[model samples]
Target: MTDQPIRVLVCDDQELVRTGYVTIFSAQPDMEVVGEAANGLEAVHEATRLRPDAVVMDIRMPLLDGIEATRRLAGPQAADPPKILVVTTFNVDAYVYEAFRAGASGFLLKDAPPAQLVNGVRTVTGGEALLAPAVTRALIGHFAERLRPGDPSRTAREDIVRTLTPRELEVLEHIAQGLSNAEIATALFITPETVKTYVSRILAKLDLRDRVQAVVLAYRIGLAGGAA
Candidate 1:
């Protein structure tokens, strides 16, 4: 919302892909391509130097992969991490999960169209999460594709729930179901602003970076399956 354009760092080893991203971002009035990196290590360095508002990260890169770079730049241990929107291939769902666990705010498939890609960067910077690519929505199954009952994260799941208020728990349920704030507001009969507030509180309470993590936690705890 500020007049200042969002500064962005584009990281991808593919020349045409990277150049396409730069061109798309360049055409946006509200976004500026601030830097570029061919691999994860350079991404870290440029991210450190440019300190961009968001990073358009590809999961595969030379020298270092995007997962490790995302971890170093957006990991829990990062002193002041920049928002990261991981761009990955649909076939490598494992990499997607690892990127999320590594602290990426959200992810888009490498094939996502320009608008969704741009929206992804905005979503992360807006302090919300982005996890949908139309083709990969059901492909990834809302972060539950790899999730099943009885994982180690299940133990932490209760701890995740214990940290939230009752209202926050409700918000988490809707988020896990892939409802937008407006939809959640409609379902809960509250204002969208209230839904947004509850979302912020939920993320803070769970020590999560965004709603994607919140949804993943919900499934991990069986909230979607009526066990939580």
Candidate 2:
């Protein structure tokens, strides 16, 4: 990693929750809590102003919601967006998917262990998607209907298929199935570094920002299906 500590912005409506997050993140030798926000509007404003390396966003907030705030900070229209790590209570599973669609790089349950929270920030900051396997399965299962074939993007899907080599396609399929680089390596009997290379090539060839989009593309193109 870089010598600079990762800058983090914590946003949560609950003061107690925000404090807890700050404490956990600030304790990391490689992290610095740059700012805090109690609502979506403040989150967007502070995140833009501070330009933190990563944002720990809450789903529910006053004024606006985390998803919209994330969109404002990191969506398709955004320029030089920072990585966003959405933290939420498991009760809001529906909103979690929307947060990802709005350009969040990763997410975690609010009740996850402190170490997981720390790792989530670092994962996003490193330009990696930080979805747990179970979360990935749930997300794909919840959105399966929206990913059916025969969409207007059929030609684009076909082009994507034609663009990737057979091995790259295999890597994409494993990624869509919520497999991490190491897991994919084991499954394919290749080294994890090799899997990483393939992942990079796949993203570059497909013009995807991260694994989240890769999973979405795999589903849309029939390379993956709802979790079994």
The candidate scoring highest on lDDT is 2
Cα lDDT tens digits, model 1, 1-228, are 789999999999988998999999999999999999999999999999999999999988889999999889988789788999888876776787778778888888778889989988888898877456343345335456446667666777677667888888888888877677888899999999999999988887777778767766677677764434
Instruction: Write one digit per residue (lDDT tens) for candidate 2, span 1-228.
Output: 889999999999999999999999989999999999999999999999999999999999999999999999999999999999998876787788788779888888888999999999989888779477777777667777776777556776678879999899899989988888888999999999999999999999888889987887777766785521
Per-model clash counts, in order, read 0, 0
* CA lDDT, candidate 2, residue 103: 88
Off by over 4 Å in 1: 133-146, 149-155, 226-228
What Cα-based lDDT does every candidate model obtain?
Answer: 0.82, 0.87
TM-scores for every predicted model: 0.87, 0.95
Per-residue error for 53 in candidate 1, Å, reads 0.7
TM-score of 1: 0.87
